[model samples]
Target chain A: MTVFYVITKFLTFPGAITKALFEHIMCKVLKLPVEDTRCLRTDEMCGHIEHELVERPVAGFWLCFIPGLLNFLLGMSLSLFGVINVYCLGNYTGFIQNNALLSNLFASALTGNANLVSTVNFLLPILFLWLGFSMFVNMAPLPEDALMMKEQYKNLNGFLKVLFAPSYFVMRIGAPLERYGVTFILFAVIAVVLAIL
Target chain B: MDNENKNEELFDEASAIEEIEENDQPDVSVEPEQPEQEQPMEPETEQSVEDETVERLNAMGDEIDAEDLGGIPVTPPDDDSVDEETESELCVMCGEKPADKSFGEDYDLCADCRKRLVKAPISFASILFFILIIGVCFFGFLLSASQLSTLQAVSDAYDQAGSNHLYSAIKSLSSAGNIGWKTAKKAVSLYNDSGYLSGIASMVDAYFYDASASSDTKLTWADKVGKGNLNAPWNKDVKKIYSDYNTAMDAYEKYYAYFSEYDEQLYYGEIAVKDVPYDELIQKYETAKQTETESAGLAFISYCEWYLANMCEKGLETELQYMKAVQEACPDFTWLYLTKLTELQISAGEYEAAEANCKKMLQINADDYYGEYFRAMILRRQGKYDEAIAKMDAVIADYENNGFYYAYYEAGINAFLKNDIKQALSYIKVCYEGEYLNYNTANFYALLNKLDNNEEEYQAALDMISSNQAQLSPTVEKYLKKQITAEEMFNGVGNPFEQPAAESEAAE
Candidate 1:
C-alpha cells in the first residue's frame, strides 16, 4: 500500500504538490503545529499534525474537506474543458478523409467571424486537459485522512451527515482507490481511449 | 487504475492502529535498561529529556480539548508524575525525548514523537512545483493563442475568397504572412466551401499556376480534389459533381491525347487530314455523355468533337445531328455546341432554325453578344440587309467598348453585302486595327480590298492569308495556292467536287 501510494504520488506529482500546498495552508490557518510539509512521503500526513487534528476534530474536518472539495471542482472543470476542446472545437485528425468536423467548425466559426472565440477554441483545452488530469488523480485525500474523516462523521449530527453523505462517500471510496493507484489507472485508460478516438 | 499490490500487507494502517490500541503500546515495545556501573548516564541528558517531554506535553495539552481527543486517552500531568520515577527509557521515534506515555506494558513514546509516526510534513519545494506547473500552463496558453490568431486570419481569408471576394481575400492573406504546414492544415479546416466550387477552384488554380506543370500533374491535383472534397461524404450534390467531373476529365484526357497523336502524325507527313481518326476522337468524348449530360466538361468535349468533324472534312450533317442530340439532352450545358449549331444552320440555309437557336443562346446568358451577332448574320444571309445592318449597329454600339471586335467585323460584312463600300471600309478598319485579328480578319480584308479595287492592299491581304498556311485546313490552303478563286473561297464554294448553289453568291 505504501509503494502504491508513493507511485500514485509520483504519477500525479503535480496533484501531490497541490495537495501538500493545500494541507500546509490549512495547517497554518487552523493554528496546528505543522511538523513537516514534504509532498512525497509514504504517509501523506505527519504524526504530530494528525494527532493535533484528531484532538481538534473540527479543524481536522476543515483541513480534509476544503482542499478535497477544491481539487474535485478544479478536476471536473478542467476535464470538461478538455472534453470540449478535443471533441467539439479542435481536430486531431485534420489530415484524414472525413475532415468533416473541422470543416464544419471552421464554417461555424467564420459565420460568427469572431477572432476571440476562434483563439480561445484553439489554445486553452490542451493545457486544461493536462492540468485537469493531475488535479483529478489527486482529488482524493490520503487514506489516513479519509479514515479520520469517516471517524469524524460519527460525531456529526444527523442533518449534517445527510448533507455531506455524497461527498463523504466519494472521499471514502476515493482514498483506497488513490492509495492503490486505481485513480491513475482509470485516468490512463480514459486518456488512451480518448486519444484513439 | 490498478497496479502492483505487493506492498499492501506492509502498510495496513487500520490493522496497525488496531494492534497498537489492543496491545496498548507504541509501534515498538520499550524495555528499561539496567544502569551499568562502568557506563553511568549523564545527569544533564536525563534532565534535558525530562524538560523537553514536559514542554511538548504542555504544548499538546494546551492546543487540543480533552473532550475532542475522541478515542485516544490523554495521560494527565498527575499520572505522568506518578510514572516518571518508574520509567527510565528514552522515546522510541526520537531518542532525545524521554518516554512520557505508555501504550502497553512494554511500549512507550514522547507526545511529539507519537504524532510524527502518523503523518509527515509538506515542503516548500512542493509549492514551487505547483507554481511551475501553473507557469507552464500560462505560457502555453499565450503561445498557442498567438499562433492560432494568425491561423484564424488565414482561414477567414480563404473563406472570403470562397465567397468570390478575391481582392479582400488577397489582402487578408498577405497580411497574415507565411504559414507553415500545421497552420495551413488548420486554416483549411476553417475554410468555408461555399458550394460554388470556389474553394476547390482556388486550390486547383494555385497548384497549376506553375507554367511547367504537366498534364499528369494537373490530373493528379484534379483527381485529389475531385475525390477528396467534391465527393465528400455528406453532400449529395457535391458527390454528383465529383462523378461528373471525373467522367469528364477522363474522357477529355483520352480525346486530347488522341488528337495530339494525330497532329504529330500529320506534322510528320505520315497521314492526311482526311484520315485524322475522327471516329476515334468522337468515341472518346461521346462515351462521357453516357454518365453525365450536363457538366461543363461534357459541353466542352462535345464542341471539340464538332470542331474535329469540321476540320477533317467529315460530314457536317453528321456533327450537326449529334450536336442537336446533345442540345436536346443538356440544354443547360450546350452553350458552345448551340453556337456552332447555329453557324452550321446558317451555312445550310436554315435561316429560321438558326434564328431560333440564337434566341435559345440568349436565354442561357442574357448578355451573350453571340446571340445578337449571329441573328444579325442570319438577317444578312436572308438578304434583309437593312434589318441586319441596324441589328449589327446595335451590337457594335452596345459591346464595342467591351472588346466585342467580332461585332464590328460582322457589321463590315453587312455593309459590303448592302453595296455600301464607304461604310464597309470604315467598319473593316476597326477589324484591321482590333485585337481580334485572326484568319477570319485576313480573309475578309482580302475580299474587301478586291471589291474596292485597292490592288496594293488586295495583294497585302492575300499575303496575310497565305502567311497562315500552316494553320489553314487543306481545303482552305488550296484557295491560297490559286487552285480556287477568291469568289469561290469567300462564298463557301471552295470544294471543287461540290457544285456551287446560286444562293452561295452572297459573301460568307
Candidate 2:
C-alpha cells in the first residue's frame, strides 16, 4: 500500500501531497467505509486481478497542444508587428543627438517600445507554455478500478463535478470572450482615449 | 495384564525417583536402610515393565548397566542473564519493544516501521534534490537573459549617441587614460552584453578618428618641465617643443577670446579698445604671462609675451617675428609650426611658399587626411582645380580604404564643391554604405537628384535630410550654416549653430 501511494504521488503535480491529504480528510469526514475507499494500488494488484484490458481515449492531448500552438502563433505575430513598428519609428526619427531634448524624448519612446514588446510578446508566451506543460502533466491516466469505483462513490463525483462544471463554462464562453471580445473592447477604449488626447 | 503392567510402571518411576534422590546424597551420610527399601520398589517396577521387559532387560543386561551412564554434567544459570540483557536495550529511532527490534545485526529497526523510516527520507530528499537542480538551472537562464538584455540596451544607447558627435567627449574621456578608459570600457562592455557589436565598432572608429584620444605623450614633456625632475630621463628636444606648443595654445586661447570680444564691440560700433594704451596692455600681458608661465616653462612665457606684443602692434611683421621666434625656439613643433609658417606665407602673398609648406605638412603626416585636404585647398586657391581634384582623389581613396566614413563624406562634399558630380556621387555611395550621417550627405544626394532629374530620389534625399538634421554635431552645424542660407534650413531642425543667430535676431 505504501509503495502504491509513493508511486502515485511521484506521478502527480507539485501540490499532489496536499491533494492526497485533502482526499484523506474528505474520506474520514464523510464517514466513507474503508472497503469502499479507492486507495492507491501497485501495478502488481492489477496483474493479479483477472480483467479484460481495453484502450481508453485521451482528451487532453488536443486540449493542451491546440492552445499551445495558438499561443505560439499569436506571440510570434505580436512580436513581428511590434518590431516593424519600432523599426519604422527608428528610421523616421533618424539619429538623435546626445543630450538634446528631442533625442532624450525619442530615446525614452524607443526604450518603452522595447520593454513593451519584450514583456507582452516574449515573456507572456513563455509563461503560457509553462502553464500548458503543467496541465499536460496533470492529465495522467486514471486507473480502471478507480473509474469503476467512482460510480459507486457518488460524493466523489458530486464534489469534483461541482468544482469542475464552472470551468467548462469558463473554457467555452469566457475564454473566447476574453480572447477576442475583451481584446476588441479594450482596443476600442484605447483608440477613443488616444483620439481624444 | 495391562493393568498389572501399568501398576508396575508407576512403582518403577517411584523407585527410580527414590534411587536418584538416594544417589544425590553424600556417600558418607547416605542412609542404607532407606536405600534398601527403595531398591525393593525399583525391582518390582522393573520386573512389571519387563515381564517381557525383564526378558528384554536380561537380553540387554550384558550390553548396558546403570554405571554405564556418562558422568553427570555441570549446568550454569547465565542463559537467563543473557536474555535479561537483550530485553533492557532500546530501539534507536522509536524506542519501542519486540516490534522495534533489530532488522539486521546491530541495526535496530522493526520490520514494518523500518520500510517507512528508510523510504520517507529518500523520497523527500529526491524531491528536494530535483527542485534544487531545476531552480539553479532556471536562475542561470534568467541571469544570462537579463545580462543579454542589459547589453542590448547599452549598445543601442551608444549607437544613438553616434560616432562623430561623441568624438570630443570620447577624446576628453580617453585623454584621462585609465580613469576615463575604465568608464568608457565599462559602457562598451555593457553595450556588448546588450548584443550591440556594431555600436562597439562605431566607438572604435570614433576613437581612431579623434587624434586627441591617443596618449598625447606630447603633453608628458610639459609634465617633465613643470616638475623640474631633471634627474629623470627627459627628452630635452621634446620638452622644448611641448613648452612652445603650450605657450602657443595659451596665447591662442587668450587672443581668440579677445579677438572675438573685440569683433563683437567693433560690430556694435563700440571700438573703445583702439584708444587703450598699447604699452600698458603689453605690460599687463607680459605680467600675466609671467605668472601663468610658471606651470609651463621660461620658453613658453617668452612665446606668450611675443604673441601678445604682436597682437597689440597689429603689424604683419610683428606676427612674423613672433612665429620666427617660436620656430627658432622649437624646430620640432612640426604640425603647429608648419601651420604658422603657411599662414605667414599666405599673409605675405607668397602662394608658392604656402603651397610648399602645405606639401611639407602632408609629407610630415602622410596619414593626416586634414593635411591632404589643406594641400587641396592651397591648390584650389592657386586656381589649380585639376591638381586639387587629384589631391581630393588621393584623400577619397585613403578615406574609403581606411573606413573613415566621416572623412569620405567630407571628401564627397569637397568633390561636390569642385563640381565633380561623378566623383561626389561615388563617394556619397560609400558614405551611405558606411552609414555616415550628416546634412551634407543628404544635400549632396539632393543635388545629384536634381542633376539626374530623379524626382523620387530627390524627395527621398530631402526626407532623409530632415531626419538626419538632428544628428549633426555643433562643428558640422557651423560648417553647414556657412555653406547654405538660413532659408534653405528646415524648421524643427536641431541646429547647434542656430543659437547665436536666434539670439542676435531676437536682440534686433
Best by TM-score: 1
Error of 1 at B210 (Å): 24
What is the model-wide C-alpha lDDT for candidate 2? 0.41
For candidate 1, what is the DockQ?
0.08
Please, what are the lDDT tens digits per residue for candidate 1 over residues B1-508?
Answer: 1112212221232344446566887755221111311145655545443335434644664433333433443333345665665545677567778775554444456667755543345555766776776665554444344445445666777676566544345446546543422232223322222222234334333321232334554443323321223222333343344344445556556555657777677666677787886776788767866775445555556656766776676676877876776566556544336777887787677889998988876654444677888888777766677787788788777652637776777777677766686787777767766676665665566556766878898778666645654222333345546686533443351232232221111112
Candidate 1 residue-wise lDDT, A6-123, digit = tens: 7667766667667667776777666554545556666644111233444455555677777777766656555554554353223322211123333454566544433433344434
Regions of candidate 1 where Cα sits further than 4 Å from its true position: A1-5, A33-36, A42-61, A69-132, A154-166, B1-122, B144-281, B287-508
Residue A82, model 2: Cα distance from true site in angstroms: 30
Model 2 Cα lDDT, one tens digit per residue, B107-170 = 4545544444323221343346445534533543443343333234434445533442233223
Q: Which 10-residue window in model 2 chain A sums to the lowest lDDT?
A: A87-96
Worst 10 residues of 1 chain A by lDDT: A89-98
Please list the C-alpha lDDT of all candidates, in the order they appear.
0.57, 0.41
Question: What proportion of the real contacts between chains A and B does each prediction keep?
Answer: 0.10, 0.00
TM-score against truth, every candidate: 0.39, 0.30
lDDT of 1: 0.57
